[model samples]
Target: MSLLPLSLACWNYDRTEALANGSVRPEGIDLNFQALEVEETFFRMLRHHEFDAAELSMSSYCVTLARDNPPFVAIPVFPSRLFRHSCIFVSAQSGIERPEDLVGKRIGVPEYQMTAPVWIRGILQDEYGVDPASVTYFTGGEEQPGREEKLKLDLPEKFRLEPISPDKTLSRMLADGEIDALHTARTPSTFYSEPDAVRRLFPDFVPVEKDYYTRTGIFPIMHVVALRREVYEANRWIARSLFKAFCEAQRRLYDELLITASLKTMLPWQIAAVEETVALLGEDWWPYGFSRNRAAIDTFLRYHHEQGLSSRRLQPEELFAEETFESFLI
Candidate 1:
């Protein structure tokens, strides 16, 4: 059997470090792993098809599904999962005390169609009775200035979004009181330099996020591994082979978390945290595959469609390659 040489672009995460470093490579693949920030990977992959396979934003991926000809198909491998509650930051002096208080305020985002902002906006509207149209949006860079959306979206007429000048960053705007709040994946520098300038919308997001998980069981998936559709069609077996490699890599990470006696982690209670998380989410907490994560994926598609990002609600089956849908009993 001939092996394929392929490019895989993704972020640098401990769980995926094995794949990047070739410690656990996909069978039959010679992978050129390009580790980069999420925004950069998503932009390059979605725009230029820069890699044969890449970790891509879920929201932008959904949008692509609605387009006439989607360029890629995804595997259920989610490299990043986060609860967006902590992503919301507000000016300390803004007087916006709760989620409901965002109704008439100005919020800044790196991109409206970005996965993190989609989750943030969807959660606010669903849990807090705040329509996206009720608030104004400012789109720009979070720390450095002049960022633009990777793709275009036809946001509703009532939903106001202003493109900030290339010179003005969201962090600076929030600190200067130009914007009332900031909704971004990046932690803006203003919060670090001037701690008093801003505070998290959920001051202690852990409890709120825990309650949210109890209610919805959504850990909030950020990125999915996508393969160029042409490449997938040409070499269908690679999908399952790749999925298996990712699963093994993830299992190695989870197994290491159980190494408490020797202290695999620097934190004194790192093992305890891992044990507690398993008790809460389940043994295979950070799972891949459709069956394990159907509810979260379904809910995300619903929000994406409702928010006018996707032309239609794309099902999990529709977006992922068929080879990745099943696994053998080994």
Candidate 2:
């Protein structure tokens, strides 16, 4: 039988490397995996429908669902999961010492609809009583000029979002004290070049992030594998096939991490790090299925709606292809 040809664009993540390198082919599919940066993949896929499938921003996917005839349908296969406490940078001279101090301040974001800032805004509101509507958000490129939101956002009147001048980058604005803080996925160049000018809101972020996880079991999913809706409508079984392949790839990675005789990765303490993570989070620390991640998904959906991104609160079950929610028993 001839396999169906399918193209996918995503970053070269360790968990998905097997799929990219052709070691783990999805059942009945000839995968053309293009390894690209997250931003490029998102832009090409979101703007042009460049691939059959791609790693999509979680918040962006939810936003699309609000529109008639949403472009993509996702599997629960998450390529990136992060605790975003370390992503918040505040101007040292702005006198924003605590999360509460962010209220009424001008904050720069690469895009107001980006997944990282959605999670950050949600966390601040839930954990520290910082309302999402209180701060005025300045949106634009983080490092370069002429960046814009990929999707048009019809946010509520309470939220204040403005675009920085075409020539101005958020990193420079934050460093120059033009914006009081920045919530972003990538660390701004200014954070390293002008350390005194920009500092992490949570200087000791590891402990704070760990505590946030303990209190709320959300590791915060950033990106999900999305199939173009037309492709998914034609071959629904591909969802399960791809989901199984991704899970198998991740399982191989987990097994590789447990080999203590010689370090499989560059880190000298990879074993210790894995052990600590397992102790903090259970054996299935990075889960992929719907049931396993329902709470986290629900939390993010609520955040999307509360922050005026999603038109209505979407159920977690509505986010993925129906075939991905379960499997046949052996």
> How well does each candidate superpose onto the true structure, as a TM-score?
0.96, 0.98
> Which candidate has the top score in TM-score?
2
- Model 2 RMSD, rounded to 1 decimal: 1.0
Candidates' C-alpha lDDT: 0.87, 0.94
lDDT of 2 at 210: 97
> 1-330, model 1: which lDDT tens digit per residue?
767998889897878878988899899998898999877798899999989999999888888887777899998899999999998999977889989999999999988888888889889999999887788899988888888988888866776889999999999889888899998887888888888988889988998998999999898999899999999989988888888898988988888889866876688999889888988889898888888788899988888877778767778678787787765413
Across 228-252, the per-residue lDDT of candidate 2 in tens digits comes to 9999999988999999999999999
Candidate with the greatest lDDT versus the true structure: 2
lDDT of 2: 0.94
lDDT of 1 at 207: 88
